[model samples]
Target chain A: MTDATGSEAGTAWRRIADELEAAIGRGDYQEGATLPSSLALAERYGVHRHTVRQAFRHLADRGLVTVSRGRGTQVTAPRFPYRIGRRVSMRTNFGAAGISVAGSMLGAEIVAGEAEACAALRLEEGAPLWQVEALSLAGGIPVSTGVHLLPVARFPEFDRVFVESGSSITAAFKACGIPDYVRLSTRLSARIASEREALLLKIEPGAAVMVSKAVDALPDLTPIHLIDGIFAGERMEMVVEPFGELPSPPAGESGA
Target chain B: MTDATGSEAGTAWRRIADELEAAIGRGDYQEGATLPSSLALAERYGVHRHTVRQAFRHLADRGLVTVSRGRGTQVTAPRFPYRIGRRVSMRTNFGAAGISVAGSMLGAEIVAGEAEACAALRLEEGAPLWQVEALSLAGGIPVSTGVHLLPVARFPEFDRVFVESGSSITAAFKACGIPDYVRLSTRLSARIASEREALLLKIEPGAAVMVSKAVDALPDLTPIHLIDGIFAGERMEMVVEPFGELPSPPAGESGA
Candidate 1:
């Protein structure tokens, strides 16, 4: 679709890919829907078939479409929107969305806290900590791998409770007598997935993974645990909620 | 740098890299500091120099270090911590950190709001909107590029005001009589940088970039604007604040 002025040159393929992406975004192309054939797209755009093929390649590379031999290109399902808020829970969020979710402990160990984890949890370096590795699955597809660290002294039986409670961190916290907790801070970044991460998340090596380093705290803002999660970028998008009252505008700050 | 159980086979290089990363995290290597030489690291880890080189290569790939001949590997400076909260302002955030911040309008145009933008702003399909493209500089380095959209009819001179106010979105909002606004929601994802984005943000092509789609609303929760920003992943990290009182724990929900 051309804008008001017209399409820019040398970006014809990109423009086509963007148009197709927008179409998908608008729900014109639903999951499992087949995209138009290259010949048809070429005719519609008045471009060569190769150009349409290039556009298809672009879409496929973006994880928007999957092309198979003999079958036409099919639009991939959209990522689940997971909200990160004060009372957020992975299980509750996925369940409320009518998605079957499950979590399983991959491994667990007790080790001295690393410097970063120690600072976040307000513990001394080399303090004993429980490192729990877990995987979250949505509809039978692994979506994230999380490494959680907690002060071992505070939660002596954390690993046992986590595994026994069906890998629910909330359950483990409750077992440890922490009835409620809130997200204190979350830092967001991204990088190419490592081989191990890609294997756990079922994505190709070097694929983008959204990394979140988050801290959970008690009602009094006492830090409880630190979690670093590697989420399959194409499988989910993070929705963050900002909490608190809006601040009043500064005087004389408006443009006149 | 081996753990209690010892490093796994075939992952020694990764383990060493992780140890170095943690050391850096602990400030063993400050910004602008050069990491230990590969030969020294190799000897310390009881590994061959090639393994050390591989570790350095991995760190460089992650944008944590830059390796150049003769000068040794240098750690990249840490990015500014940008807080996304009730009153989120790029200029204000960097300014409070004692960093010189500036923004400039790269371009502006009136275009029909795309489906996603329209949905966020609650406008009719194809509604005319002013799209302001801006670049944010912190300490004279380009850190982010933002494309902000507002209903054209509501802010007729938004582009001019924004440009004249030194590219401050707050000033344009004030010009439109919106004294205050709050961040309603933000969605974050990541993707490989496009060539144009790489050039604009001064990052290498194919590098990871953090993408955020945010909605800002009035105090009463009426959506006013939408922004899609591409931030250099290696250059900045997003910090978010949670709003509202902590919810009481659900009865009988904790593990016994």
Candidate 2:
């Protein structure tokens, strides 16, 4: 409870922030949910809206909420502990977060391997490759859209098998006799999402999207898959535990 | 040289793409610079603009160029190989890229440590701390803007010392008797930049910016600094080598 009886304006905001923090801690305001408008809060507290804004700033500085222009203040959600280890599987990742991922298969075709994919797979130029497009969802929330390029020589009809496995890449790999694989390398960048990507992810066209280019390899370190992923930035935060469970590679070679 | 003589429209784009790739390899067109407009390229090659666009798409798929709607196709710049290791230093990173970083100090003040910084630094809430703001540029290209919170008890007058050291955090640490420090933990996300941040980084407002929250600790694992960095995402790429040079941490605790 805050003493609203003519307290100093500075301490007035402090008390408001304290009360809001307690409410948030009690789960009255859920994460990724907006709080009352400044005017509304001000009316309830009998203080100026500026005081309410000050309180919001305090909470934002404490990492409990975020304040953006045009968008009201919202409770900050705890970022998903996205692990970027050798084995990078979307299903495994969301499952670890206590959420089941529903994967949807998008465009699938047999096409000539592009130069980038060919180099990563160590195949000759114009090699026949299976190109598969897919999306992963957690609790019906789309997480990422990816394009997978696999050498047709290695897995003759991976696209069809992928759909047959309920869009589970792991199941498809297992069906193809790959019991285990490791992510060889991953490069991360962020940029404004294009119209097509935003439409697929159901986000604003100008929203941020994290672009990841990764290569997955077989147990023997043979490149098997080239993946390009576009992730809705606001929905995910990647945690890279570089040396968490794995030992360092040999000198002059890192994550090859 | 590509034969301008009539050929199948399909392979015509292929030959044009090959020639442009060779020109790029020869450094005729530098990274981050746009090529001739499609109309101009079409006139030169005696082909329709659609054929030139097809060529652009080929190069884009090959990871050599990026084609945006308004901005013409530009050779993709090699992203800075930003390494996230136990010891993270912007000066060291740009230096390795053969570019010297110029640091500019912004707002600096003594402030009460907010909950987030206090929790990271193991200080009491409202603990007195020195808040320093700075930005780093590489070859006059702004790389990142950061706000650092350091315990005033440990590094009294550190802000003044930082300014005295030519706005170099590394040099200021040395002056404060901290010969070396290691980055304890890092968390990364991306979002649209604020107007002030965009202006500071000289990027367009609403552009994507990678946000990093990190803690730097002394050699004995005592956190000394809490850093919040906003990076211009288009200019940088993060390379996280989890197990590149370091062995695994103790079980159950990683990157502590």
Candidate 3:
């Protein structure tokens, strides 16, 4: 009965969501725990089951709940373990962990590199660069959106090459005649996601996101790419092993 | 005077802050850009200058503005660079940046090691651990709060040592016959601050926080301590170097 009309239904669901949120915030529900069924919640709130479903969807978008086919609705858990260290292959790592990931190109454009990008790519300030925006999803769930920068002088028309290669950065690099690359450095911070970012990631507005600025370098330490990644913080954890086994760098070498 | 009484003053300041927030979100203001003077904002809002100050204070607590001496109120920029690599000493790094930092003990208790802590410390499930909570401030601004866990068998009365040693972790380690330790691994995630954490960090209720779970090990890779650090996300950037020079582990040796 609460779903009298369009706007009325909207307001009713939001009210239910707010009450549920307050209950969750007060520890009335625990993480990895399931919520009552939609029919049960509808009866409790004296609303249509569709309205309860809408409320659940809103909470899921906020990263507070997970909706699965057989599992029903459960509190969100950090399920993805992202590895960050020397010699990390996202495809291999997440694949081994039974997570299927896919990348799609959002757009491509040539722009002047600013301070953060220029510093990461070891280019002069305001240098021309090819910027490509890509979104990656795991298990059909949007996980990260990355802004990739490549020096225009080094990789001309790289953006086209990226799209032609199905938005795979590695494929684009190989087409550019680079066999391999290594992550040189990364700087991470966290903040509330902007409106555009939330839309792209399918997360709620103002949701917390982990931002990483990373530089990829060639074998000789020549910087080739600068990547700014925005990760949905609720579903991922970045793992680092400081003493991981890796080859030693040559003595007295400075990265370009 | 619009600010007639206590609750009236509260409502007046919040209204101004909400309007300014909308302006900032629309990109009317830029990062690292100074806003108009308090007097100017007061004239625009038709409120007292004191009311404007309260609005600015509210925004600052939400990580939107910076009110520093002589600098007036500029947008907040990430100023603290936290270095994370093979060897990291918070005191040494922040001190090198000319920022004064102090650590204060919040509380200590004996608790059972949860899954995260047990795995980090390589302890049996449900093992006893000493959990010491401490807060660190940089230039009198709260930056991080850390929960440190140590084996109850090895670090008896370690909480007492921590308190007597001016809440210095290094001093406590030395007193417990640990000459040195190094971080072996770190796992990081980000989320909205809880009620208690927001109060301790002096941030808004739902502000983002970067959580780091780090394990410090002895020279032989025996896990010595587990630290869970909650960092105020707005003012910090965590820097990581993949190729930092460090000694390699001995052949075929596995961490404990």
Candidate 4:
């Protein structure tokens, strides 16, 4: 189970993990194959039972294995790359990774702006805006539910575009002459899901999900969109890249 | 739970959640105290029981409440401000937040550099370095455990300073004549815990933790420290700030 140049070392468990990983890679242990129990592996490797458990833990982290108490450890098939590179549309991201995107639009309507939404759009409170709520999916599995706001006066027919076309959000915005946008800021935190969200994401009540609030701006610095996305934490990761310097100032006038 | 402005036009559950949050702020519900059951809240707020449950979910995300099956929704005190400010010592950060630091040094030993460590430290594969493993605690709760590597040749009296001074690693390096260092880079990821780390962090095996690998460098571009820290995900946050601009090309290293 060693690598071609076997220099990696740890206690017995790590060695066993490495060997198991190699066997998985070599197809000796196919995806979904049940691995020997910790007791069995311990007996075979002549190590403590705890040592075998450690080996399984290492494999789990690498996405090579999953353990269920009653079912034991089983190989996990390699998952599609869930990349969070900023250069793609959210829709394109899932599509490129071979995941299906399927979700019913909850609602789309023009409304008087709420205080937070107005501030995010750089408009006065009560200004006209289009708000859209959608459940986003990957591989037909609900991953996030999001609400997006955009100034309706700036983008007339926003609701129609959302309703009639399956185009990317960026495309919809570009059609309104806001050709380019840069993400100005984002805030991330975690929280338990509501029953509705939990049902959508198919997780327990107390399971944590990532809450992301993002603001984007047009090239001329006009605020364009404010989005609140709740992501299933166990199924997702977020990547942030700070350009040239560290600690860019937080966004918004009050920095709230 | 009205907002200060007291305009409520959204869903019933949202307003209920807001009112409950306001009531908490008003000291109507003490921290750790169970809230009225969903039925009770629904009756008081004139909403459905499910709507009250939805309100509780909102409070949970704000970190103000926790809900369990047997234990109803309960108020929680504000979480510790896990400051993620860039470029602060671990001790300094925790100290500023009024948390004490304690450690049980798992081991401190001279180790031959592995290939990965050698590449990171720019040393020969067999070069000697001091590897120190410690379980660090805050508020008397173990929240992080880490391993640090320092070049043994540079800190000639490493063991003596670490043993005698009881100072932080940075201070110990300063005592050995290396007075300044800058963190070069950090890599971040997250994964569920293993049996060993789970025991150390006092969490279940599937609980997530934050993982960071950082390299610190001295003025002459020599590596000073290589640190790998794992923080309890629910208990800590990391802030990073980049400053100024990237270094320009070296005169001696002209490129075509």
Candidate 5:
């Protein structure tokens, strides 16, 4: 084990990668700036050329850099924070940040909820839900392809509002007499996007997508929204802030 | 735009990919089963061989299958679930799930708190803190790398219990007469693992790692634990439960 300097410790490639990563993070290599060739990196770090390549490969996989066959690797443009911290609608969240939220209605139809959908929304089996598939754009660039489910009984005007406004579904619910909502739970998974999502997001089908499944509740505690968002992992960041009160001490416990 | 399961979609490769993905998820081909040849898949799906290849590439990128030029693609074995859901200790969470938890103390030393560390633990800048690094294993397989920060002034005998038990930092706190703690907040991010963490977790540097920064408070609201855990993305899963009271309707509006 080594100290924070990360020298004389683990595998040579790893040490090289750490130092290089810190350098990149510290803005030693600005966005779109070409990184050193593997040979040059090897010479500087005193490691095999392949070690540097492996390090670069790692950075490429994390969407931190771009590597070309003949041309040298370059640091990637950093993505803006796609805030997923609050219970706000995706459209409003971006719109509030002055980013235009635009996407065509890929499809809009009433369908029997899938088993996974039923479980997430806490609805009965085969409940009818409006499954609206759409893509979300940030400043006219596709950033995510997703599907949102609303219980048909709860949002009777879903299709109408969806086609016209394409804004916050929760806000639309407020217009329909449900003013507010709360997010219940979320499940996160990373996977290769489906060919459709990839095409919509303008990335390779095998590209990573960050999948989030959330259950939202109406003011009366009724589950109304089960949103399944699939974001181009290369384009977005999901944040979570957990809250809780401190545990109480046993009776007569001293402060010390 | 493509409608649900209809003809005249934008791309044939996407439709083929979706069908294959659903089939695989539904267990049409079990783990270790070889998928049909690209030529055969093209014939069956009425698409070009290149389309099938594209579909397979998507599967491979998600680590769902492995492809050999001559042998075709085979379903990959599913990985174990790396639980990061609850506020429980790493040892307790894995142990209660009947998974063995083991780790080697990589390094431990008393040091002045860094700016970030001080802010996290609510300690004065440059205050003495016990910094410990460890690599954790589950079922004899490395899954996470962690660095812990403990205020030395609060736990005067921190080093002794850490070396003796090596099970959990929470247990160490109990031995120091501080019990009943609550997790205050947890912030998560996806990042490339440092060289040291990559080596410890048996993943390549630059592989996506789930980073969680958490602060723990004592029963009496004294900040105690500031933990930074890096979990191997291939194995980790974080299930977050968000609970809040739903908002009520604004003054007296009946059904619109």
Candidate 6:
């Protein structure tokens, strides 16, 4: 621990908390492991006990550790890892991780396509779309919500197929005679949840969420559908893997 | 607009805000376009002017639009799109978007490898590693901060080469005789920015930040380095593209 005497109390405490957080992340304190006593930490950092206590409070607030009356601060379990690859499927990903997964249809309807959906599906303006909203659960805990939009002309009665197949989009595609599809692209952003989303996900209104907008395509690069998903940030982490070669740059410069 | 008679004022306002935000995102209102008047929106939504005003306030607070005395409300410019792919060069990505990019070295040192770095680099315990901290700027504004860790033995003069090459990690790798590399995997999460990170990125403390942990490797699968980056959530969007075939699934039954 590096001590700078002139730093403010808040900065000092934050620095200490950051160090401890990094340590916990590095598995210095494994899952369910208790941290050292406040007095010991203070002595190690050459700070007052109260300062160490403040640091511990900060860590607890960040959901990194839990404190109880009888027990000391204990680290929380690691988050579940979800890999996004060429043939991505939420069911298969969580199943391989030893977590049972299920999907339930929240609602389904035919609606006017939004510009994003129209552009991604190459539909003209005013095209009707089959929109399906569903929630995915891992071990019975809601982890993500998805809104999928497909061209109604291409996949008529998609909602019926989706519901009849127990809310599996993959199965619904097969019902539409599509054997397989590939992920075309994914755009990621982060923001705080809205009031309605918070209620649905059972989290605070301003809690963090990871948002992804993705388009799936057929093997020949024809888009099939577009999906917008909001994932609970604390419950899942997204892993991205390379699935194709980088597009080569135009030739211009000579070899160095 | 869908209206529910018994909904709370907050819920109604949020609904209006959500609709307007979706419109803006879909380019119904292009960048720098002015939104409809509060009176017009109120009438369209069958709500009072004050309710529409509240919705506008919410949009402003979320950095989606700006309201002025004479000009009314105007949407802001879209964020820079950063595509994460097989090559995954920030310079190339920003250049294709016509944005001038620059990087500056914040700090560098040789430190004992942590678990993540050691595991990614396949290094033994207590191995020394070269760590570099940098800030990437797009159009003269800082957008991301990166902490890169590499094996010291592989690139002994990495720090000097990186600084001399105008803070280009790709150039430094080339200087070390590495002609090409590919991205192996990327993990993404979102959280509130810490005080130090907020200061560095010129954002408010506790604002949302997208964090990515990625490993780059040689063509034959030898890991090169690991990068942990924090991006200002509101300033940039990440685009993930597939670069290889997904791992084949085990033998299984056909369709249901």
**Higher-TM-score candidate of 1 and 4:** 1
Q: Which docking band does candidate 4 fall into?
A: incorrect
Which residue pairs overlap in candidate 6's backbone? A243-B243, A243-B244, A244-B243, A244-B244
**lDDT tens digits by residue: candidate 2, B1-256:** 1123345897789788878887887778888889899999999999999999989876775456877779889998866768777788888888886898898788687777756567668888789988788898988988899888899999898878888987788789999999998877776777887766798899878788887877778877788988888888888987665435322122211101
Order the candidates by DockQ, highest first — what do you get? 1, 2, 6, 3, 5, 4
Cand. 5: chain B TM-score: 0.74
Instruction: Single out the weakest 10-residue window by summed lDDT for candidate 6 chain A.
Output: A247-256
Q: 4 or 6: which has the higher TM-score?
A: 6
Give Cα-based local distance difference scores for all models. Answer: 0.77, 0.78, 0.75, 0.65, 0.66, 0.75
Q: Which of candidates 3 and 6 is the stronger one according to TM-score?
A: 6
lDDT of 4 by residue, B1-256 (tens): 1122223424787678767877776778887899999998778877778778877876775556877678798887543434332244666768886887766566677776654566678777668988777687878888778777878888766666765545376667678887776655554445555567778988656555665556777756466778777766656654432221212223211111
**Candidate with more favorable, higher DockQ: 1 or 3:** 1
What part of the reference interface contacts, as a 0 to 1 fraction, does candidate 5 reproduce? Answer: 0.26
Backbone clash count, each prediction separately:
2, 2, 0, 9, 0, 4
Each candidate's TM vs. the true structure? 0.79, 0.78, 0.70, 0.69, 0.69, 0.76
lDDT for model 1 comes to: 0.77
**DockQ in order:** 0.26, 0.26, 0.22, 0.10, 0.20, 0.25
Kindly list the per-residue Cα lDDT of model 3 for residues B1-256, writing each as its tens digit. Answer: 0112247776788788767766666567777789888999999988899999888876764456766557788787644878787666677668897988788888787766654456557678578988788898888888988788899889988878888877777778889998788777777878777666778889877788898877788878788787878889887888777786322223212111
As a whole number from 0 to 100, the lDDT of residue A254 in candidate 1 is 17
lDDT of 1 by residue, A58-84 (tens): 677445786655678889776687877
Please give, for residues A1-256, the per-residue lDDT of candidate 6 as tens digits. Answer: 1123345776777678878887886677888899998889889988898898889876764457755446787786655778776777787788897888788888777777745456668777558987778888889888889788889999988877887877777777888898898787777877666565567778655667787777888878788888888888767778877743222222211111
Compared with the true structure, what per-residue lDDT tens digits does model 5 show for residues A1-256?
Answer: 2255344433677667667767776778888899999999889988778889888876764456777656589887755454444364666667776887776667777777755566556677588988877777888888876677888877777777766565556546767777677666565655546566778889754555666666777645567787777676666655554443323223212111
Tell me the TM-score of model 3: 0.70
Please state the Cα-based DockQ of model 3 relative to the true two-chain complex.
0.22
